[model samples]
Each structure stands twice: as C-alpha cells, then as structure tokens.
Target chain A: MVLEVRDINTSYGDVQILRDLSLKVEAGEVLCMLGRNGAGKTTALKAIMGLVRPRSGSISLDGVELTAMPAHKVPKQGIAYVPQGRRLFSELSVAENIEIGLMARGKGRDTRDRVLNLFPVLNERMKQRSGTLSGGEQQMLAMARALCLEPKVLLLDEPTEGLMPSMIAAIRDSVTELRAQGVAIILVEQRVDAVLPVADRVAFIENGRTRDTVDVETLHGDLSLVHKYVGVGH
Target chain B: MDFGPYLFLAVLEGTVTAAVLALTALGLSLVFGVMRIVNVAHGEFFMLGAVLAWWFSSMVSGSPAIGFLVAIVMAPLVVGAIAVLCERTVLKRINYDPEATIVATIGILYIIQQLALTFYGADARPVQAPVNFRVVFPWFGYSGYKLVVIAASAVLLLATWFVLTRTRFGLIMRATQFDSETAQAFAIPVDRVYAVVFAIGAMLAATAAVLIVPIQQAHYLMGGDPLLLSFIVVIIGGLGSIFGTVVAAIIIGISDGVISVFFTPTLAKILATLLVALVLVLRPQGLFGKTPR
Candidate 1:
C-alpha cells in the first residue's frame, strides 16, 4: 500500500466528526469514498492532509508516520489536496497559481509544461486571472495546481460538482491517466455511476465510520449498497 | 505674496507629505491585507523608527550626512527586527484573530510609546538634513532635501511593487494574501510568511519615519498622527490594496497641505476625516478594492 490510514478519530471542538475511520489505497489504485453529506468523507481527507489533526489513530505513507506532521509540510511529503469549492487564489493569474504549486516541490518549468499539457485549456489563459475563469475552467486550474506537486497520493474533494457531463468526463479521464501512472488517488465523490469507471474500490462512510469497503464489481452486483449508504439510487 | 507662489509651495509641501504617508500607510495595508489584523501599534513602529534614527545619528561623530545615512539604514533594520519579535511572540500567539490582534496591538502601542518616553525622553529632537541645499523656484525657494525625500520614496515604492508583483517570493505573498489556507496546502509556510510580512511592513514604516525625522523633529508621541493618517488612507484606499493606499495617501496629503496653507491645519484634518466618512458610507470596499463576490 502506498498510503494507509488506520482508525483515525477527528473532531472540531466538542463536536466529533470522524470516528474510527479507516481505509487504504495502494500505488496505481483509485479509492472512492462514498457517503451522504456530513458523513466525514471530507474530514478523512483533511485528516490525511493534516489540515485537521486527527485526535487519534495512525496515518502512514510508505510506512512514514504523518499524523504528527503539520499541514504545510504534508504537501512537501508528496500528498496534494484539491479542496472542496476549488480554492484557487482567485486574484492571482493562472500562471502564478501554477507557479505556487511548482514552487512547493521546487519543480521547474518542465513539470509545469507537463502539467499544463494535462489541461491545455489553462495554457491559453496563463496570464488571465483565475477568478475570471468559468466554473469548469476553475476546476481544471485547481486540479492543474495540485498536479504540479507530482504527488504520490492525490486527494480530490468533489472534483465534478456542478459541472456539465463533458467536464465530468474530462475529470474522469484525468483520474484514469493519473492512476495509469501509478499515482494513488482518494476521490470523495457523491455520484456512484460517475465514480465506477475510475474507482478500483469504494469505501462507504456513515456518521464518521467506514461502513464497508467493497470492490467495484461487488458494488456493481450490489447496487443497494449505494442506496443504503448514499441514500440515493444510481 | 501672491497666489502663485503660495500654490506652488503648498503643492511642493503636499508632495512631500504624500510621499511619507504612502510608505507609512502601505505598511499598514500590507499587515491588514495578509494577516487580516488591524495593527493599532503600527504608529508606535513609526515612532520607534524616528527615535532609533535619532539614537543612531547621535552615536556617530562624523559629518551630519554620515550620521544621517547611518540612521536611515539602522533604524529600519532595528524596527523590522522588533516587528518580527512582536509577530512571533504576541500576534502569532494570539493566532492573529482580528479582534484579539487589535487589542494586543493597542497594548503594544502603549508599551513601545512608554519605552521611548523612558529612554529617549519627552523632548522633540531634530536631525540635520544630509544635504543642506535649496531648490530656488522663480516664485520661491524649497528644501532640496524634501525633493530628495520625494524621489527616494518613489524608488522605494517602485521596489516594493516589483517585489510584490515580479518575484517568486512576491507570488507567495500574493497567494497567501488571497487564500492562506490554500497557500498552506501548496506547502507555503504561512506562519513564516506572516512573520516576514510583519517585518517588511514595520520596515516600511521605519523607513518613512527615518525620511521624515530630518524634516520633522523626532518626538515620543509623533506616532499618533502618522498612525491616524495611515488608517484614514488605508480605509479610503480600501483595506489591502497597495495602489489604493498610495493614491489615498496622495489625496489626503495634498489636501492637508493645500488646505492648511489656505486656511488652518485643524480644518485640514477635519476635512480629511469627513472625506473618510464619505468613502466609508458610499464605497466601503475602497476606490480600487473589488467588491466581495
């Protein structure tokens, strides 16, 4: 396994969020987290990224302890997070945003060029302010910024929210491409049908606990699992 | 005797005031923009700069010019270091919460002011201008050092702009300013960035204080006016915009100079205060500040 998160419990003040959540993803694997709203899926990602410290349990990447590391240092350790709502530096130019990501890893223009190739739409708007980009373009730029890290593990929080089917397909294709290159991905997605094409496994979370971890084929055979955990039919 | 010479003189004086005010207000703006904290003690940093300049210049026995040069370089560095200390010890400890920072900085303001009073005394001491010359206008003569102050301020402003817009560190600062959380996710050490930014802001204020100390005497309470004026400029310019801060400084500075020449200094301050009230009522975001989406 490339990344292992074991029995992590996290809370915001008195209100507990994630309780005993556990999952693992190997290199070249895509682990999709399925849950209803407020099921602690995003909190799980934040715990891994060290944005929100887990109250207990272990997070290890390649057998290196990460639970105690600060949030800023997590990116340097080859874990990149594209947060919910596509938190691009809205006032900054597209080029500057990419530069910030590249700067994190001390990567050069070569890495920038490669990342830009993944989202060619960004190249034309290099000098344009990111806030002016359309919703789809903003999502692409957010992904591009994270990709600049060339991270071993990529955590995407709802990458396809409010996008057209075409843009959704584009995102799935990028995930597929990253998986092909042996990058471990933890995708927090709401739609079961949208995740099946790229996800190798699905971990259902409910009220801060991992309800089940099943293979894509297993979930396919048991569509009711999605209805049970997500409270929606595919 | 006529309106021509009076107008020219007022404009000249206004330009000098604007130059110094821009540097001071830019410092305030940067701290607010990045850290989202209102530094009530910012003026104390200015006061400390002026007092330190006096101390440094007094230590040297050579040409007044040499002493002035030493004061200019040493004062800002010393003030910048103090600011870093403050950020790490007080501001960082408080987590830079807007309300807490305001109260903490107010406490810092009194501490620094009292320290200066105890050490530097209550006297308003003057430093000699590095260059003692006058620019003779057809209508009247003006201080050559004042012109130098204006030119030097321009260079510093340009340098600051270059650092904010062109350099990689500048990119990190802008990124942090826009969204510090995301900047952290990208591996930008935001706490360190806050420390550096606080230092830079203090350095800018100190530089302004050093430049003005030769023209205006260095007094323990001199920080009060600059601090108040900087708040007016920052508010009118919108909170975090460097360009707005500079532009607002010019407007307030020039208006204060011209109005004081025509009428009274007290009236000039009243007018500027009224202008701020107007800006706040109508364009709360500032002239150049983008409206929140």
Candidate 2:
C-alpha cells in the first residue's frame, strides 16, 4: 500500500470531526474520497497530513508510521498537502512561491523549471505575485509548489472547489499526467462528475465515518448508498 | 541674543542628537519588528550599555583613543550576551505574551537598575573625548565636537542601511518579520534567528551609548530619556519601518534641539510628549504603519 489510514478519530475543541475513517491506496493509484460539506473530509486530510492531532488510530505511509510529526516536516517525509484553501504565500512571487517548497532540499531551480513546464500558465507568470493570480491560477501555483518537493504521495483537499469547468478539466489532465509519473494521489472532491471519471475507486464518507467503498464504476450505479449516506437520492 | 551663531549651534547639536536617536530607535524598532514584543526593558539595556562602556574604558590601559575603542567593543558584546541570556531563560518560558513580556521586561529593568547602583555607585562616570579631535571649530563657541559626532553618526547610519538593503541575511530576517510560520515552514530556524536579531539590536543600543557617553556624562539612569524618546519615535515611525524611524528621529531631533535651547528642557519634553499623543490619537496605525491585515 502507498498510504494507509486505519480507525482514525479526531476532534477540534470538544467537537468530534472524524470517527473510524479508514482508507487505503496502492502505489501510483488515484483514490477519491466523496462526502458532503462537513463530513470529516478536510479533517481526515488534516489528520493524515499531521496538521490536526487525532485521538486514536494509526496512519502509516507504506511501512513508516506518520502520526506525530509536525505539519512542516510532513512534506520532507514525502507527503505534500495542497490544503483546502490552497494557502500559497500571497505576498511572494510565483517563482519564489514554488522555490519555498524546495527550500528544505536546499536548491530548487531545476525542480521549479520542471513544475513550471507542467503548468504552462505558471511559466508565463513566474514573476507575478501569488496574490494577483485568479482562483484557478492560484490552485495551479499551489500544486506546482508542492510538486517541486517531488513528493511520493500528494494529498489534495478539494482541488476543484472553486474553478471554471475548463480549469477543472485541466486539473484532471494534470493529475492524469502525474499518475503516469508514478505519483500516488488522494483527491478529496465534492463534484461526483469532476472526480468520478478519473478515480479508480471511491469512498463515500458521512457523519465523520467511511460509510462505503467501491470501484468508481460500481459507485456510479450504487445510488442506494449515496441516498442513505450523502443525503442525495440520485 | 546673537541669533546667527546660536541657530547654527542648535543645528549642529540637532545633527549630533539625531544620530544618537537614530541608533537608539533602530534597536527598539528591530526588536518590535520581528518579535512583536515591545521589549520595554530595551531602555534599561541602553543604560546598562552606558555603564559597561564606562567601566570597560576605565579598565583599559592606554590613551583615550584606546579607551574609546574598548568602550565601543565591550559595551555591545556584554549587553548582547545579557540579552541572549534573558531571552533564553525568561522569555522562552513566557512564549511572547505581550502583557507578560511587558511585565517581565519591566522586572528585568528595575533589577538591572538596582544592580547598576550597587556596582557603579550613584555618581556619574565621565568619558573623555580624544585630545586631537577635541579641537572644536567654534560655532558661536558652542563646541565643534557636535559636527564631528554628526559626521561619525552619518557613516554608521549609512552602513546600517547598506547592510539591511543589500544582504541575504536581511532578506531572511525580513521574511521572518513578515510571517513567522511561513518562514519556519521553509526551515529558516526561527528560534536561532530571534536570538541573533536580538543580539544585533542590543549591539546597536550599545553603539549609541558609546557615541553619547563622550558628549554627555554616563549615568545609571541616563537610559530613561532615550527610552522615552524611542517610544515616541516608534509611534511616529510605526513598527518595523526603519526608514520611518530615521525620518521621525530627525524631526524630533531638530524640534528638541531648538526647544531645549529656546525654552526649558522640561518644557521641550512636555511638548514632544504632547505631539506624540496627538499623533497617536489621530493615527494609531502610526505615520507609515499598514493597517493590521
């Protein structure tokens, strides 16, 4: 397995956010987690990324345990999280923004050149500050910055939450290309259509727990679980 | 009342005073800029610097030039070492609670003051200006060391400017000032940076004392006036804008020189305080400060 999260439970300020949410992904495979607005989607990602502390369960990437490390160290350990907000350093230029990812590795020009090539828009606006970028452009910048780290597993929380259909299509293409590079991805997304076509398998989450997991093709037809867990009658 | 000579004297005095104020304000501004700590005890650090410089000068066996160099060298290093100790031992425990830091630094201030009284006695220590440089160019016979002091201070200020604007160290320091978490995320080692920055600030204050001791007799309590003035300059300049501090310090320096010469020294202080109050009330964000994001 590339990454495994088992029986993970977490809370924030006395309010529980995750309960026994378990998911597994093989190397280079695309895994989609489906849920409504507050069904522990972001929390699970935060817990896995070490941004939020969990009260119970173990999270291991491949064979190495990764439950207690600080969020800043997580990227160095080969997991890069493009947080829900895509928190790029707003004051920094795009090139400087990407360079921050490789700061720990000591040199970034080569990685930067490569990431820029992946996202052509970033190449053209390398000197422009991150603040000036549009929503889609900012998302691309966040992803490009993380890619500079050359992370083994990329955890993206709602990468297409606020983007045009064209941009969403572009992101799908980018992820597909990333998969071809043998990079494993765990995509948390709201739109079924946006993620379902690309995902090999899907996990439907609700009320801070994993309600069901099935192949994406099977999940598309299994409208009964969707009605019960997602409150959507399909 | 011969206006021509008196006015030129005041201008020369103002130039000299501005240099001292510039150095003092830079240290205070640097601490507040990066740490977000007011460092209320900073003034006390200046007081300590003056006292140490005097003591070290007396200990050195040489001409007044060697004594002057000794003061300049020892004051900063001593004060900086003390600063590092305070940060590691006391401040590390407080975690930079503004109220807590303010209270804690105040405690340090009084403790240092009492110790200074015991160590150096209540009497003032005089630092002698070198004989060769003491050839005063008579500006209405008000003394020409003011002009020499002014020139020397200008060089230091320019050097500081060059280092800050031109160095990679300044880039990382400025980055930390802008956002602590982001800088640390990039592995800048924030804890070490904070200590180094604090040491640099203490060194600047120590340098200010070295400059001023020759002009004004060193006293244990002399730090109070500059400390108060730095607070006003800080308000006028806003936090972290070094350029703003320099501009504001010069304005205050001129106003202060004129007011002290024409009016009483006490009245001059009152007027400066009043002006600062007016500015603070009118624009709390300070003259060059950005609104909190």
Candidate 3:
C-alpha cells in the first residue's frame, strides 16, 4: 500500500466531524470517495493533509506517520492536496503561484516544464494575476500548482464541482494521464456518474461512516448502491 | 518679516516635516504590512538611534555628519536585532488576539521608555549639526539642514519602493501579511519572516530618530511626538497603506507647519489631529490605500 489510514477520529472543538474513518490507496490506483453534502469526505481529506488533527488512529504515507504533522509539512513529505475551493494565491501572478508551490519541492526545471505542459493554458497567462483567471483556468492552475510538488499521492477535493462540461472532461483526462504515471490519487467527487470510468475503486460514505465500498466495475453494476448509499434519486 | 523669504521658509518647513514624518512612518507601515501589529514602542527605538549616532560621532572625534549617518545605518540594525528577539520571544504568542497584542506592546513601550530614563536621565542631550551645516539659502531665509532631510527621506522611500516591487523576499512578506497560512504552505517559513520584518521596522524608526536629533534636542520624552504623529499618519493613512502615509505625511506636515506659523505650536498639534480625524471620516482608507479586496 502506498497510503494507509486506520480508525481516524477527529473533532472541531466540541463536535465530532469524523468517526473512525479509514481508507487505503495502493500505488498506481485511483480511489474515489463518494458522499452527500456534509458527509465527512472533505474532513477525511483534511485529516490526511494535517489541516485538522485526528484524535485517534494512524495515517502513514510510505510507512511514515503523517497524522501529527502540520498542514505545511504534508507536501514536503510527498503528498500534495488541492484543497476544497481550489485555494490558489489569488493576488500573485500565475507564474508566482506556481513558483510558490516549488518552495515545497525544489528539484529543478523539469518540475516547471512538467506543470506547464500539463496545464498549457497557464503558460500563455503566466504574468497575469491568478484572481482574473476563469473558474476552469483557476482549477487547472490549482492542480498545476500542486503538480509542481511532484507528489507521489495527489489528494483532490471536488476538482470538477464548479466547472463546465468541457473543463470537466479536461480534468477527467488529466487524472487518467496522471494515473498512468504510477501516481496514486484519492479523488473526492460529488458527481458519482463520472468516476466509474476513471477510478479503479469506489467508497461511498454517509453520516461520517463508510457503508458501501467496492471495485469500480462492481460499483457501476450495482445501481442500488448508488440509490441507497449515494442518495441519488430513488 | 520679509514675505518672500518667509513664504520660502514655510515651503522648506513643509518639505522637511513631510520627509521626517514619511520616513518614520515607512517602518511603522512595514511592521503593520507584515505583522498586522502596531508597535507602540517604535518611538523609543527612534530615540535609541539618535543616542547611538551621538555616541558614534563622539567616538569618531571627527565630523558630526559622519556620526549622524552611523546612527541612521547602525541604530536601525541594532534595533532590528532587538526587535527580532522581542517578536520571537513575546509578540508571536499574543498575535491571536488583536486587542491583546496592542495592549501588550503598550506595556513594552513603558518598559523601553523607563529604561531610557534610568540610563540617560530626563535632561535633554544637545548634539550639534555638522560644522558645515547651517541655515543656508539665506537669500530665502530657509535652513539647509531641512532641505537635506527632504532629500534623504525621498531617497529612502524610493529605495524601499524598488525593493518591495522587485524582490522575491518582498513578495513573501506581502503574502505573509495578507495570508500567513498560505505563505507557509508555499514554504516561506512564516516565523522567520515575521522576526525579520520586526527588525526592519525597528531599523527604520531608529534612522528617523537619529536624523531629527540635530534639529531638536534629544530627550527621554522625544519619542512621544513622532510616536503619536506616526500613529496618526498610519491610522489616517489606513493600516498597511505604505504609499498613503507618504502623501498624508506631506499634507499633515504642511498643514501643521502653517498652523504653527499663524498661531502657536499647541494649537498646531490639535489641528494636525483634527486633520487626521477628518480624513478618517471622509476617506477611511486614506489618500493612497486601495479598496480592500
């Protein structure tokens, strides 16, 4: 396994948001997490990134304990997270935004060229401030910013949530390309229909617990899992 | 009183006062821009600079002009180092609450002021201007030292502008101020940056203190006016408004200079405070502050 999470429980001050949430990802595999609104999907991702601390249980990437580290330290340990809302440094230029990501991984020119090649739209608007970019462009820029880190495991929170159909397809293709590069991915998506083609495995979570988790082909065959667990129209 | 020469003198006073206020406010603005804390102890740091310049000049046994420069350059560095220690050891922890941080810094201000009084007494120390320096442009009846102040302030401001716009470290500072967590996510080491910014702010304040010592006698209480004026400049100018302070300083300088000429210095002080208050009411962001995004 490339990443292992076991019985992780977390709370925000008083109220518990995550309860014994456990998920695993093998090398070169796509793991899609499906859930309704407020279903602890983003919380789970944040817990892995060390943005929120887990009160109990263990999370390890490449067998190194990651649950106790700070949010800034996560990327340095080979895990890059494209947080919910695509938190790009809006005031900075497109190039500067990308360069800031490199502060985490300063390997060389290959990182810059690789990120630009993946999100070619950003190459033209390198000097423009990131706040002016269209929503699709911002998402591309956000992902590209994370790509500069050369992360072994990419954690994406709702990558296509607010994007158009064309942008959605573009993101879908990018994930497939990344999958082929032996990079493990954990995608938290609201649209369950799209992930059947891209993900090798699927886990359905509701009310802070995982109920139905299955292989992608198996999940697609079982429409009742979509209706009962995913809460898609019955 | 000859009208032409007096008018020229007034213009020169406005220029000199603006330079003084603007340079001092630069460091205050820098600290606020990066750390979002109003360092009330800044004026005392300026006094330290003036004292250092005098000490250094007396040590050299040559031109007092050389001593002033030493004070401007070295005093800030010393203040900056002290600030680094002060920030890391003290201010970093209390930053979670804005009101608490301001109050804590006020306590620091008292401590610093008392230390000055203990070591250097309450009596005013007289330091002479350079031997070559005197009221020049006697044709216009204006002081040459005031013009020099204007020139020095302009050069410093320009240098600061260039560094902020054209450097990566500057970008990091901006990011840290605007959104510290994001800055750290980019691996900027936000703690180290904060310490450095405090140091830089101290340095700027010290330089202003040293430069003004020749015109006004240095006393333990000397920090209060600049401290209060700087606060007014920053507040009326808006927090973190670097360019706004420069423009407002000139406006305030001229207004105060004119008021003092017409009436008295006490009346002039009230008018200066009123000017800042009126600006705050009409345009809360001051002359140069951008609309918050």
Q: Give the winner by DockQ.
A: 1
For B105-166, candidate 2 gives per-residue lDDT tens digits of 89988988889999888989888765344444454344455566677777877887787656
TM-scores for the candidates? 0.99, 0.84, 0.90
How is the predicted docking of candidate 1 categorized under the CAPRI scheme?
A: high
lDDT of 3 by residue, B1-293 (tens): 68777766676676677788888888888887778777888887887777666666666666677766666677778777877777877888875256777887788788878887897788787666653446646574455676677787889888888777678787777777777765655556777888888887888788777777778777777888888888888877776777788877887777677666667778878988887788788987776775666
Instruction: Score residue A150 of candidate 3 by CA lDDT.
Output: 89
Q: In terms of TM-score, how similar is model 2 to the real structure?
A: 0.84
Every candidate's DockQ is 0.88, 0.29, 0.43
TM-score-based ranking:
1, 3, 2
lDDT of 2 by residue, A18-121 (tens): 99989897767898888888999988987877767889998888778888766556666677778777777676678667766776445557877788888988
| Candidate 2 segments exceeding 4 Å error | A1-27, A30-74, A120-129, A186-194, A197-218, A221-234, B1-5, B130-138, B141-166
True-contact fraction in model 1 equals 0.83
Q: Which digits, one per residue and each the tens of the lDDT, describe model 1 over residues B189-222?
A: 9999999999999999999999999999999999
User: Ten-residue segment with the worst summed lDDT in candidate 3 chain B?
Assistant: B131-140
Give the Cα error of residue A26 in candidate 1, in Å.
1.0
